[model samples]
Target: MTDSATSVFEADLPTLDYGLTDPPQQIYPQFRAAQQAAPVALGPIGPEILSYEMARTVLRDPRFVIPPGIHLSAHGITSGPLWDRVTRSILNMEGDEHRRLRGLVSRAFTPRATARMHDTIGTVINELIDDATARRSCEFVGDIARPYPIPIICALLGAPREEWQQFSRWAEDIFKIVSFDCDLAAEEPVVLAAWDEFDAYIDTMIAQRRRQLTDDLLSELIRIEDSGDRLNAAEVRMLAFSILLAGTDTTRSQLAASMQVLCEHPEQWALLRDQPELAMRAVEETMRHSPSMCSTVRSAGQDITLGELTFPAGTFIVVNTYAANRDATVYDDPERFDITRAAPPPILTFGGGVHYCLGANLARLELSEALKILAARVPDARCVGEVPWKPLLGLSGPVRLPMELCR
Candidate 1:
């Protein structure tokens, strides 16, 4: 949005590891305090783009590739099922191969498709709140956040809906690999164990779907695989796993973060309660202000230049959505968390280009609906105890949110 003719060079850059080492609460504030565009190198995490204009440039350009495999390898998770699982995902894919796989399944994630689940999502959240209605208090994370997204995503994939806790646990452990707190080498067992269970679960589901076609995404994938038009059985399995992994805990964290932010802004919470229709814009502000995804990692496939700066090939960098979302150069009052702002510029929370999150529509819908119900039902909800954060910036949210339940 702010396409100023500013130029940046490594010599003048800050040397922070982005949010890796700072206290979670200081991430954005520290970014705002910095005079440089970004760190010369974010320690082992690589360089980052902090300005709104440069972040957009790097993300939309085809030369900056999503390189999960290389990042994981650098962290000592060189090989195993965990490595194989991430490296083969749509997250790590590129070029024609990426397009081919995405084309076959993209229809299921479209806005129209996700919109159909809105009422269903509302039903689930209402039921979740109903279950917690009698309690004097509840751990917001475990009671509400964890169960909220599980059934919706599972139902989307046509998996067993009753296994919400199982999937939640798997997602929690598996997602740690992306968090800065994760001890990759030490976490191999827990992460792989989750993958193994998820793999077997899909194995059985695929077998059943093969016998009878359903109207779900998995059934669609199986049909394509059997047709032998382009997809293979392994691809189908990984694709299913990828969707499940992507949609589950990430959405959970988002809902939790949304609730936390709203807790801090009770007047806005009152507004959402009084006018439920404002849910969408309220959730958008939540994302722009306290996005679950703080940054997106990328690697330059070839030497690339931005204004007066030129970066060599293999340079890993991040589109610092956390920083860019609050760039004073872009928003009139960037630090203000107001939901009623008109025509807010595009947020880089979901990133851009072909690597943009496929489940973004659903995730947004989930959070908005969750907020709608939450505001109506828990209007007086307040955090009664210390709120533990996820220790790292990304996939960022409160680890455990303890809140008083309204009767």
Candidate 2:
């Protein structure tokens, strides 16, 4: 561990600008340099959490809460469909309301619950690979990464399989909010308009589900809504919306990211091809190295102390998860992308604590299944061209991955 006595570790140490907007080539080294210093340092926002322990502490601490609309509101977006949609979503909620929403849908996302999608996820992967295998070369993001997760999520929601394309387009556009590269203000109207279209779409689905009362999650939600104590119409819609946003966007970005990392490491790629059971390990390594959600911010609700630092209420600690995941104290040879790295200390990619990603099990199951299937099917898959990457400051992944799947 680095010394805390240094000026670089000063509590007031000027914002540790990791030069987020710069290319990742420049940004990652900056993170590495900072990790050599003390764990806690001030970032452009507040204190950027660097160490895995510190990050874990901050993320799990009860005093820190994610303030709703802090992302868009910081840029002067206060209200509208975009604001209402985000602020009302289950992801941004807190207290009993948050607890209640989570409780209602918790069973639906458990490991056992998500594992039900394993076969469907594999089937989707095979169909997707079959398409790419025929082309030999395909823009991985568009052809595979972008569209692959939609069907599984759709199946969960009990929606028609054909509706996957429409849902994908809407989810992709709506997902731009999580990426720093997206100009939210410029995208607000467009995103809100899509929300309106989605608003109608989901309403129709809910109505149909209400009438037919299928075994789908949506119908279950309707039953809960009608039960009077469990949920209401708005809550039902919001819960479903939260699942859609969290499920589709993160999985899409992460699958592309997983592929991007595997393609970069030919040896690891081949290793995975030979041992498909390593799919879980490979996905973990990919997430540790190339996470989709770049960082998550937690706002302190009161004064707090961690080791040598104190943060006043309202102070925000941004968990640079990508950096913290590589914290040298926890991971051996942290910089190396090795799927076989034994006992990786629970990668902070999906985060920790109560707000830990609701779709984590599903995401992992999806990625693991995808990795094994792809490795087995396209044994020679590799990055054939430069990847147009998303900003490392937000949801990061290849916007376009030129991949050649040589069988």
Model 2 lDDT per residue over 1-407, tens place = 12433322345443466555554445777677777886876766667788899899888876789988876876678887678779878788888877777777775566765776777888898998888899899998888887888899888887788888888788877776665656889998878777667777878888887679886677767665323556666666777777877788688888998888887888998999998889999988999988877788888788666766776668767888888998988989888999998887998889787798888888888999898888888888888767776666656677888988897
Candidate 1 at residue 1, lDDT?
9
- Candidate 2 error regions (>4 Å): 1-15, 23-25, 179-183, 222-228
Cα displacement (Å) at residue 80, model 1:
3.9
The per-candidate count of clashes, in order, stands at 0, 0
Cα-based RMSD of candidate 1: 3.7
lDDT string for model 1 (68-186, tens) is: 67657757777777787788788789998888887777756779878878877988999889887778578888998987877887777787667766777787787776656667888
Local lDDT at 220 for model 2:
68
Report every candidate's CA lDDT. Answer: 0.77, 0.79
TM-score of each: 0.88, 0.90
In lDDT terms, how accurate is model 2?
A: 0.79
